[model samples]
Target: MQEWWRSAVIYQVYPRSYQDTTGNGVGDLAGITRRLDHIAALGVDCIWLSPFFASPQADMGYDISDYLSVDPLFGDMADFDALIAGAHEHGLKVIVDQVLSHTSDQHAWFKQSRSSRTNDKADWYVWADPQPDGSPPNNWPSNFGGPAWEFDPQRGQYYLQNFLAAQPDLNFHNPDVADAILETCKFWLDRGLDGFRLDTVNYYFHDQQLRSNPPSQTKQKEILTEVYGMQEHVYNKTRPENLGFLARLRALTDQYDDIMMVGEVGEEGRRSIEIMGEYTAGSARLHMAYSFAMLSDDFSAAHLRDCIEGFQTGAPDGHPYWSFSNHDVVRHVSRWGAHAVSEESMARLTCAMLMSFEGTIGIYQGEELGQTETELVYEELTDPPAIRFWPGVKGRDGCRTPMVWEKHAPNAGFSTSKPWLPVKAPQATRAVDQQGADGIMAHYKEMIAYRKSNPALSRGKTTFITLPEPLLAFTRTAEEQTLTCIFNLSADQHIVSLKTKAKVALGEAVSLEDDKLTLAGNGYAYLSHGAEVPL
Candidate 1:
């Protein structure tokens, strides 16, 4: 039988900002457990919680010190079990983030590996000797800026870290390390986790020979501001050996019934979609894989079509998971504001488009509220990249602000005390309570409900329709019906010329007898053959 995640809408929750039941200013597993009803009300099939594992908090929980233990900041194992149980009770599947590509420098295995070259676990992590001149082995740059190799004088070698120096990449070449990570996954699978959201899925392996990556063939444009993207990033990530490790992960997930795994393929260019295709091509690998293709500033219809069509052609058998916003980047409403009619309209239109796509959907928390990016001052910045880059890059902390539950409550009811990131007025105004009755939240709930009610929208095959610029039109066809989805992905109004008579299905039932449909800016409409509209 097909897994639930194949046609599911997975909601992403950033644990630190999701809720704060302790009044300690930080979100914990208990806070998440208390808020499971809100998630269930959103009609999501699964909740993909960000990592809350034990970490030094250097790069947040992504730099995990212990995989088996929960960080004191986020509660203990009992809390985690409760969160899982609560989520299940609400009829929502639980998918936790797993950072298997790397571990915290504080991890016991890495500590032992860095202590001495003769240690038993010395080969557990990727370590290499410096050149004769004492220079780093390769020219690979870290994703967080500076060198990817950190000099460890104790071992007389440089350790590999694709991300922050504190988050050292594990040596997957070592079979023991791979087995150990799999065992950690089993620990959670046994505890009744639905699956995992594999972080940095492509950074699992590196060039064994430690080859230097050459310059990018494409012209160096300022558009790719992230320092890591300045280089070609060949040998540092996306190695061939990563495939076998993914296969191993798939085998482990297959041990549990109805379990699935979605990998985050972080790569530049079209390589992201290509990697997604390869990673999820067969039953031996990931169940689904998502890339940054939809997360970019490009909101053009052509671009969207290219991204979806590219994946369709590349991985005919592979499944794709699509998301526009997450904790790592700026909110889509603000990121693409120039092209949107309004933030609220954009949120509805984007969600409608996502629901219409032929793949799994991931909705980040606060998206339903039509939340925009919060303004963060220098002192309020906790994200390293934002602090290092300063005014130029506002960083991810703005997007990671605490979720607002009440408008007038302290810190908008996210915390009784100060939170990790401040909850600004703009974000607070769109709080969950305010929107619950008759706001964007209602629209989101309605949209999700509409999708669930329609078989074509939920589990249908997608086919792109020939539409002009600024209009993204597609038809989702199932055995019982065919639904046409049209979106004006621009600030300017678009006139959609229809070849046949149809009735709008979701919002309003308007007949397209004139052979032309007028769509407002950032407008979207779902059409069916009948005149009777569901709404």
Candidate 2:
């Protein structure tokens, strides 16, 4: 059977923002089920739901307290089953976010592990003795802030805390810990789950020696103001031992039919691509992987070419998943607005570009409406970074605001009561009900249909075509089909002389006459490269 995920497009639903049915101001599983038609209408093959598992809400639902149970805030187990059934009925595969890297401090396992050194679960978490000077074991910095270790008076030792203090990293080196995590994953798969979007997949293991990371050679900072960007991060994460656990995960998923796992590589630049290659290079590891490469602020053709070519050279056998927006980052339409004619045009351009790429695609909620980030004051912020560092950092709350379903309804129809995160005017203006036939939503549906209709665009090998600074071009070939994709990644129009005569397959603001093509700002086109034209 053909693997469903290779050519699939995934729609991500942030449960807290998708829809709220109980009027408690938070979205639930029933709300997702209620909105199944909206997702199915997009013509996507699958839906990836963000974490709705049991948690203390410390780091949202990422700090999973119980992997096996549904969070009461989202609904009960019956609600989850109904959602799964509803999605399947819509002909959409359901894949949930699996955060196995860490657990909340309130988790029963963490409580037992931290209580005493002799307990059965004592070694379940990474624990280390402080230096004789009463300091942390090493010089590792947390991804959030401060040291990566937290003091525990009861154990007289520090535990590794990769993110917030409430989240403790698990010890994957222990066989039992690995077994238990795999079993949790199996529980979900057994319940008719299509697969998982493994959160921070490269962070599963750390160096057994607990060595301090060296200073970064490239000094490539994810967040320049943060201390975590200063180190090369060879020890704390992206460890070689992570591959073993990934193989184990693959073995478990392999037991089920047509199950797929796509990992989220939490690295930057070429290193991120390299890790993506390693993690998905073989059938024994991740089926596919994605990184933050395309999610950055760099929107130039040169940057886009470099990322695609770098991945093609590094991981020829591995498959990649690409996305421009998600729960954690700024919306791409706003991030790349400087290079576009307008928000709607930019959204249409990206929809065309991402659809023509060579692997699986992920679309976040509200992206179909060309949604921009919501502006918020410090008083309305709920994200940790924004709360901790007020004016200096605008946390993820801007992107995590409630999704808008209605144009003029209260809270933009996301919830009946006040939402967990407020929905402002800018976002509410682009509600689903507001989109017309020629709007961004229609453009998305059109491009998705175009991609599915062309086999070369969906399942073909990519070859970059050299073009001018503001123009990016590539060819995708499979079997007897070939397509040339060209894009003008600037806010200025340019006309280029085509080397050969080819008819336009799908695109906007470009025509072929006397071997010439004109592309307006942010305009893109797919040209038939061979004699066999795609209908």
Candidate 3:
């Protein structure tokens, strides 16, 4: 098999927010097909569509109602096929998201399961009896808010819901459920899709015992989003049974040539990296797995080193997929701007740093334009988290705004009519067309090209070098190729001395003098071996 995904940079497209051709206040699959050339021009190898499956839109398209059908909001089967064919025509692979862990309350399977206990599909979704007091089965909390289990009068029991109550978790404990989902994968594979971005891959199987999660030692008072971090999450998710399920998924994908799978392991810090390792540890699992570790506010050199090293230690043979921002979180430029010289400088720096890492790369849309988080008022909110806890947790709505393509076009060129999500001035100012002359957009193209042109960056062993504060440095060594990469993680100019003679392989916004590299705030560089630092 080609293993083309090993080093390919995957670009994620949030379909409802990408582009709108229907003028129905939303983006559809046809919109994506129309913009295929834009994605190809970005130099990415693949496009990972968020979720266009038949959904009720409770959590955007994450709450799927039908595994094989595209939601009417995003177009139908014909539009999806056109997207796949068009992407391939542009030399870009297509990786659609698979939300197998759960489905919308309106799904036929869930509906059938809730109607009666004796039905053949009754056990298809996770269901349990409430305690004598009529409370939820256990202490499991939903990622959105409130109890993770919802009481259902129809079945006289509580159903498990890790996210919105509208999105019920599937009962992977059922062999029939596993078989059904696998068949769903076959449906897409038969449609000629290249790969899958497995949504909540680690959340597929919960502990059979349904143990209560213990409270964390650290109090979570930051925002509503951080409340879930207070639990140990020992049983509700990250189960061992998931490994077996992943193997089945891998085996199915192997049946098709060059097909790949990258799981989204939703965890933080150590546990996140460990799961990424375990999921991609062998040939019978995912090709790569990404965690929320890199999607956090941690920008220190030590933190970056620990995240990568943690994965390496957990599974020596495992591969990783790294990203700074996605549809689920704030844009990295805005999230990390507190320590940056400026959004433009920091955005470019993050791009270079991400490419230099020893794994595959995933870029969310609008990031290359140095886009910031849009400030949405209470009325503009659609994401569940923000709705429940307003000012405390802004939710993901700000990040899910429509992509700004034109400077003066109606609706910022995202749609001819009003967009499903509003496109505010702050975000629209960083429009794709407006940034073409200079700035982060141009830098991203250069950085991605640089990473692709150099084999060492995409397919090399990475070694982190200990340096003083604010300077993250590492070297990538592959067969007959070697390159050193350095980044300034702070908004203060600092210079560091390099022990080895380095040739300027690729650099800007920094200078070298007699082995001393001077990096302005947010500057970065890539250098090759055997050349003296410029004097």
In terms of lDDT, which candidate is strongest? Answer: 2
Q: Candidate 2: which stretches are off by over 4 Å? A: 220-224, 529-535
| lDDT of the structure predicted as candidate 3 | 0.89
Rank order by TM-score, top first? 2, 3, 1
- TM-scores of the models, in the given order? 0.97, 0.97, 0.97
- Give the per-residue lDDT digits (tens) of candidate 1, residues 182-257: 9999999999999999999999999999998987877766844466666787888999999999999999888789
TM-score of predicted structure 3: 0.97
Error of 1 at 512 (Å): 4.4
Query: Over the stretch 1-535, how does candidate 2's per-residue lDDT look in tens digits?
Result: 5699999999999999999999999999999999999999999999999999999998889999999999999999999999999999999999999999999998999999999999999999999999999999999988888899999999999999898999999999999999999999999999899999999998989989999999988746466458777889999999989999999999998899999999999988778888888999968999999999999989988888787777787888888999999999999999898998988889999999999999999999999999998889989988887788778788899888999999799999999899999989999999999999999999999999888888898898888877787988888988978999989888889887776678888888676776778888888888885522121
Compose the digit string of candidate 3's lDDT tens values, residues 396-515.
988889999987888899998878778888787889878865677888888899888888897989877778777888779889788888888999988878766676778768998778
State the weakest 10-residue window (summed lDDT) of model 1.
Answer: 506-515
| Total clashes for model 2 | 0
Pairs of colliding residues, candidate 3: none
Each candidate: what lDDT? 0.87, 0.90, 0.89
Off by over 4 Å in 1: 223-225, 507-513, 530-535
Q: State the TM-score for model 2.
A: 0.97
